[model samples]
Target: MSELRKTPLHDIHQSLGAKMVPFGGWHMPVQYSGILDEHRAVREAAGLFDVSHMGEIDIKGPHALDFVQMVTTNDASRLHAGQAQYSLFCNHNGGIVDDTLAYKISDGHYMLCVNASNTEKDFSWIKRQCTPDFDAEVTNVSSHYAQLAIQGPKAVGILNSLADKDLSSIPHFCFDYANLDGIDAMVSRTGYTGEDGFEIYLSPEKAAQLWQSIMKAGEKDGIKPIGLGARDTLRLEMKYSLYGNDISGETSPLEANLGWVVKFHKSDFIGKEALLGQKETGIKKKLVCLIVDGREIPRPGYEVYLDGRNIGLVTSGTKSPSLGRGVAMAYVENGLDKEGQSLQIMIRNKGVEARVINPPFYKKST
Candidate 1:
């Protein structure tokens, strides 16, 4: 196997004794301090994450908006300058290419935040679809910036101290260009963990410096660097779909409960035909949340059963730190997917009883 790539925060993670692991071809910290501790920290106080491994692609020019609208499932026209919206790219047959965040920098300029693993493929796929007739440019600029996420109830207060502008006015899904501790950055009110948080996008050279500054500034607020383990648990609790795991090139957005992102009223987009057909014919399977009755943690690839007959496979599963139970998401045959329906998850040759339920398992404290 090839060597794993390291993010800009590699040295910092090593210095802090993080348990590094290979994830999506990157050497990432799976845990530091401990997964449970880090998970609780983010829930109660605040935690920082080095998400520099994410990919960024810039699309600009007169036809940028038009091209983006044609390729993505979301309505780009709804986004104003400085606003961001969750969107997805789908194959012609309706399978997902990747779930992405579309950032509208201006009318004729946009940025796409895609999963690290699918960056190259996504860029190439998008470029291939840009016909010569359209005046647009696509650039894969993933390496140009490092990303950081500060998440929790206290995230705003901690980051607000170091930011030159007031962050409260940004609102959810909105962003602004700001100077953070003298470093230029694109600060957005966005995050994976269903918490009030901010993600900072800045040059790689300024990453470590800004990381240290934020940690020092938030010391009184109990801020610590979080690792990927908690990041998974946190997002899982929120039912945020992880690429390749929960949603992938093999899955359709409608079957994955992402129908809200698909806009059919707009002009034709990639996969619109297939998606429309699927909607007309109805999906054969659906993604649903599963909560195990016992401590036996459910895992991916495990068979899901209904009435002693195998019906589906687990996609993502874990012992939820917030709920204190084994929770999971699985794609089950359509007829069996209903909230509160009892099912079984096969773990180690034994069928563990589980219940199908609606997600966002851990409600954020209001």
Candidate 2:
């Protein structure tokens, strides 16, 4: 008996004949057709993602803005209603507690989308941080909503066919509530893949219907049901860091190469002081993207070497479906972290030649 939780679309995933697997305490589809097939679908046309397992927390009231400013790196005061910003919450020691998306719904209401693994921890942390004068009311609404990502080049066209709302006006990181055939939903112009797309949040009960509609609308463009394997690859290609894999408590934002996301200018957020200190001290172990020279695929935990001497380990690696080669991101000694420097990855007791490449391995063709 798998102890993992099931989303409302669990049955739908089964009906679609998806190969289910456990992911972060939830039973999710690892693939529908195949990883490569699904990956190509999203890359060439459109693909649907069942991301309902993600956590959503709502922050409400007059002091909501103030509350966010105290917890997150981005200045929440900069966000207007219906806008979303990518941000981070850090521990005092400059370690990333979690990376999150903050969406301002209205004048005093906001929604924070977080990684599923950190839902409880994030909620508890925010609760403790709410001040006596902070008039915000926080609620964990993860189970109340279901999120579907419609991604690819033709995603907008497919989305346009399914809903009445005009998506053209909805710029990136912006969202609006609209009726998807009388099912109240929030549609946001955002996606993990480096392509034009939308993420739809709606009632769990209506998710299957919406999912079917999206596929039908995108039939001409060749939409396919994607899974976690492809999702990971897509985000990796975009150089987007995964929570536990790329950035975690042990990894600081500066070392993870996400220095841009960490806003030090903000007035006193968690980890601000520590991050500033680390920045001045010089980042020692920094994340670097690498491309293996041969057919040998480098996997995570593979030791990295500079001049045949061990210095780091691969944090995340994959046989890049898009690149037809092995690519990985790893924490390496700063002194040996020069881009284009020749390095080695220990794969199966064998040293494989590799080179430090500027992340992301997949660059959009001009």
Candidate 3:
């Protein structure tokens, strides 16, 4: 068996008594104090996450924009310098290669943040697309940096104390290079927890320092070091899609409820023809949010039933700490994917009642 990789913060996590587990080829922390406590901290105050296991790829050259536009589903031309957009790399058959965040550093330079498990596969797929016709170069730069996420309502104030520049000036989905606690880093106003936060990218050597600094700065704000367990529940509450579970190589972006990122008006892309054809023919199944009627938590691979027939399967599910109810995301037959539609999730050979609901089960009030 291959050995598991450790992030720069692995030792720190151990020092803090975190429960470690293997995740996406890395030895990551599954929980610190506890899943529920950490989850509540993020929703009410602030929480920090070590996300250095994610991959980063850099693309640069004269034809970078053209190459990116051809490879990704989103229109890269729409991004200005210092801005980022959620996008997807699709196969020729319209299946998702991976969903990514594309950062436009300049006209000819861009960065892509991809899932940890799909790093090498995504890099290889991207490199193969760089033919002699396009003057673009792709480089995997994951090892050069470490990432940290400080999330929640109190996140801005905590980060502002250490950031040299006013973090509020960086708008959502945008980033800026700044000095964070004397460490040079790129700070982006983005997060996976569906809360206000910043994702900081810095040298791997400075990661542990920044992590400790942030914890110290947020001591009075009831900040806690969150782990993967809470991270999953947090994103699930917001109905954010997980790369392998919610959407995968077998799923199309349109069917995953990610059509917003698939721009058809732009020039042709990798799966444009297949997607257009699917659009014309109609989507057969769709990803939808389901609120369980009881406490039984629906799990991935659980069968979804309607009228005594299996129609779909749960992709991601959890008992939402914020909503205090069982929630899930699943792909169901298109006609039955309406609001308040009744369905059943087969758990332990017994069907648990569930109902379809619009996503974002929990939203922070303004």
Candidate 4:
């Protein structure tokens, strides 16, 4: 087997006594103190994460906007400079290539933040689409930057203390260039944990310094370094889809409950025809959220049953630390995905009762 890659913060994670494991071709921290503690910390106070493993691809040229609009499902024409939008790259058959965040730096330049494991593959797929007719150039720029996420109710306050600019002014899904304690970085008001947060992108060399600075600044606020274990649970509680698990190359964004990002009104895109056809024909199955009964945790690949007949399988599942119960996202027969529909998940050969519920098992109190 090939050697696994390590992020710039790998040594720091090791020094902090993090449990390291292989994930998406990188050795990443699975937990620091513990999954439950870190999960609660993010939900209540704040938590930091090293997400440098994610990929960044830069597209630049006069035709960048046209290229971006053709490749992604979302309408890039609505995005102004300094803004980002969640979008998807779909295959010709309407299957997902990868869900991504498209950051519009300017009219001539754009950046795509994609999942770690699909970075190289996505880059190749993107390059193949840039024919001689299109003047855009695609470059994988993942190595040039390191990413850190400070998330939770207290996240903005903590980051504001260290940033030269007011972080609260940056609207959701928008970004700005800022200096944080002498570190030049791009701070985006976005996160996967379904909380108020900022994702800082800075030089790899300054990553450790910025991480330490943020930790110290938020010390009194009860900030903790979170790991992948809690990260999964946090996003799971919010019903956010993970690339490989919840959605894959075989799933369409419409069936995954991500139709909001697919704009059929836009000019032409990769899978426009196929998606339009699917829409006209109606979707046969849909991804739904489930609140599992009792303490039994549903896991990926677990079978879903409706009246003892197999209908689908769980895509992502966990015992939610925030909700204190097992929650899951699964694809089920289209007509049976109602808010109060009843279903069962086969766990350890025994059927566990679960009910289809509207998304987001955990919501912060207002």
lDDT of every predicted structure (CA atoms): 0.94, 0.88, 0.95, 0.94
Off by over 4 Å in 2: none
Worst 10 residues of 1 by lDDT: 357-366
**Quick one: RMSD of model 2?**
1.4
Residue 313 miss distance in model 3 (angstroms) = 0.4
lDDT of 4 by residue, 1-366 (tens): 789999999999999999999999999999999999999999999999999999999999999999999999999989999999999999999999999999999989999999999999999999999999899999999999899999999999999999888989999999999999999999999999999999988999999999999999999999999999999999999889999998988999889999999999989999999999999999988999999878999999999998889998899998988778899999999988999998999999999999999888887789
Q: Judge candidate 4 at residue 302 and give its lDDT.
A: 96
Question: Whole-model lDDT for model 4 versus the true structure?
Answer: 0.94
TM-score of 4: 0.99
| Displacement of the residue 250 alpha carbon in candidate 1, Å | 1.2
Tell me how far the alpha carbon of residue 238 in candidate 1 is from the true structure, in angstroms, after superposition.
0.7
Error of 1 at 325 (Å): 0.1
Model 3 scores a C-alpha lDDT of 0.95
Q: lDDT (0-100) at residue 62 of candidate 1? A: 99
Give, for candidate 2, the lowest lDDT window spanning 10 residues.
176-185
Higher-scoring candidate on TM-score, 2 or 3: 3
- Show model 3 residue runs off by greater than 4 Å: none
Task: Tell me each candidate's TM-score.
Answer: 0.99, 0.97, 0.99, 0.99
- Alpha-carbon RMSD, each predicted model: 0.9, 1.4, 0.8, 0.7
Q: Rank the candidates by lDDT, best first.
A: 3, 4, 1, 2
